[model samples]
Target: MMRSGLLLFFIGLAACSPPVTKSKAKIEEFRQYLEKSRTDDGVLLESRMLAGSNGLVWENSGKYQGDILLDDSQLEDLVADFAGVSNDNNRNAFVVANTRWPNNVMIFNYASNEFNNAQQNAIRTAMSWIEHFSCVRFRWRSNERVFVRMTGNPTGCYAHVGFSTAHPNRVLNLARNNHCFSHGVIIHELLHSLGFQHMHQTYERDSFVRINWNNIISGQEFAFTRFPRNQVNLHGLPYEYTSIMHYHNQAFSRNRQPTIVPLRSFSGTMGQMEQTSYWDWLRLRRHYNCPGAWNRNSEEIMKKEVERTLPLIKLNLPAPKQGLFTDEDNAYVRALNADTNNEDIVNEEAMDYEDSDNENNNFNEDIGNDNYEN
Candidate 1:
């Protein structure tokens, strides 16, 4: 009986061991993967591809029109960031179905044959950097519609940036050599897709012009631009030197003469960094409703932002009372009343005079007739 009891206990222990060990191993593997893949403090890597099943269709309607080509590796980089996956296996599994999403991005690229290696790399880098903060996608076209002719038009008007209500595609001038290394231009154009207007009027203007957030940010525009106006509640973006979106060349000249500085010196001229700002990250995180990856102070800062924007939201909303009038309105009403009273008095006086005149005329006639009879 003792031997039989011991045998039963050993069989039960053996039955539980495999399942427990397997689950523990699986958890350990997952934990290791998380540690390696985590970026920006466990924030998932995020980005979308530019192409879709039907492929890119072109119409000769808008400015900065051209074909877009997407880089797969860059797309992978963005996915790694979105998934927060350090393990190669996990990332592959997540993105296997699709690299692009319906709402995330619209990629614009040219055919592989048309673009050289340098231009391709530049596009990839620019897209990757932008994807770090925003949930935008890419749209690559097979045929090249717009060509950048350096000799014919050195400024390359073909490479244009524009946004519209119907199809919001960011047009990149891939033909221009100037834009080849221009990450800032790429980001600036992308911001337009996200509903940001130009920071300064012309490229000739100084880059350091201060932005008044209250004056510029509107809910209507925000909705149109597809950016989270609520998330962009800060006064201004931080001055980041390393931000890829910063102006490439300083507008200031040592000779005290206005000159078009190269894109490389744009940030130095502006006295800001070439990298993305803290405000930029904040806006992206809020717009996407991303999980908490920002610093502990971020919560406090976001709370303040919410408070700061409450008044603006209220200002945009229609007032509850419909018939309420202001002091100016009251003054106008009083003036109109006074004018009406004056007109009434003048009419009354005119009527009284007419009656008196009629009575006088009859008396004059009677006196004249009696004199004649005498």
Candidate 2:
């Protein structure tokens, strides 16, 4: 009887399963999910409907990938900052940052024992960069169960690199023994954490070489950009790359070399006090808007600020249309749709498996299965 039931199940599956087809909406959604998933491993699953995209699988891999580490006090501090914005428009814009940070911010180096003074200083410097420019706050937590281990290089050193559960937030310069190490990398990664895609080399206007945006893998583009037309206002003012939230690398040239001068040349090392950019100040002010003089519990006020500001943040890319099937270009749309849907269902089940208890022990085994639907 058990054998007969199993044979019947197989027959049913064979009859129901269809072939793959082109789905433009699914493809575009897959692309967006791929872009957002790179920010952090945890939220990758939440970002898209793709069954087998690498970003989705990577997200389900149980690794913590965010930069902002928040403890109870820090969370309160951030909440208080949003409470201070007076203008309803500005306050609405501010709340977007608040909603994005807590769950989006993954914890790293939660225990003091995990880092030394220099490492702590590195973390502080990275945090300072985000705070001063990005208007985001960092905090520490006591929980280890939620923490994900960094793979690749392990010398038991925890200060290698840090990012958001979504993107690179703050990377520790464990590679640099001297204090003169570049904070630009941390800044660069932080921009990625914030959902900016790399600029195309052909479109760049500065002395810096533009990134080959086309070269970016389909899903990874969001790591370096705001949507093409999306204009994000850092504070009450307009946003600009000079605001310190921009990526700094070898500038545009026939031959690639560092085009922009190091920030340290104008200022000092991480310890040296530096003047904040206008945009930076505005970002902080917007982020921490409160009703009173201090505006400590301004979460509601900040929410209003974000709601207003979101419209201003425009994406350069065209709005994606739903139900646009890619694989069906000249082929039968019905057949293609059936195939894609079948693949999507299988991929979803696989993702569920990857997210379960067997993840760590079965990572290698699962990676092969993950590449199937992509």
lDDT of 1 by residue, 80-131 (tens): 3333443445433432322122344453555444444444444554454444
The lDDT values for all models are 0.29, 0.28
TM values, all candidates? 0.33, 0.32
For candidate 1, report its TM-score: 0.33
TM-score of 2: 0.32
- Which 10 consecutive residues of model 2 have the lowest summed lDDT? 4-13
**lDDT per residue (tens digit) for residues 189-294 in model 2:** 3333333222221122223323454443344332332221112222233333443433334322123333233322233322111222333333443433311212
RMSD of each: 33.7, 25.4
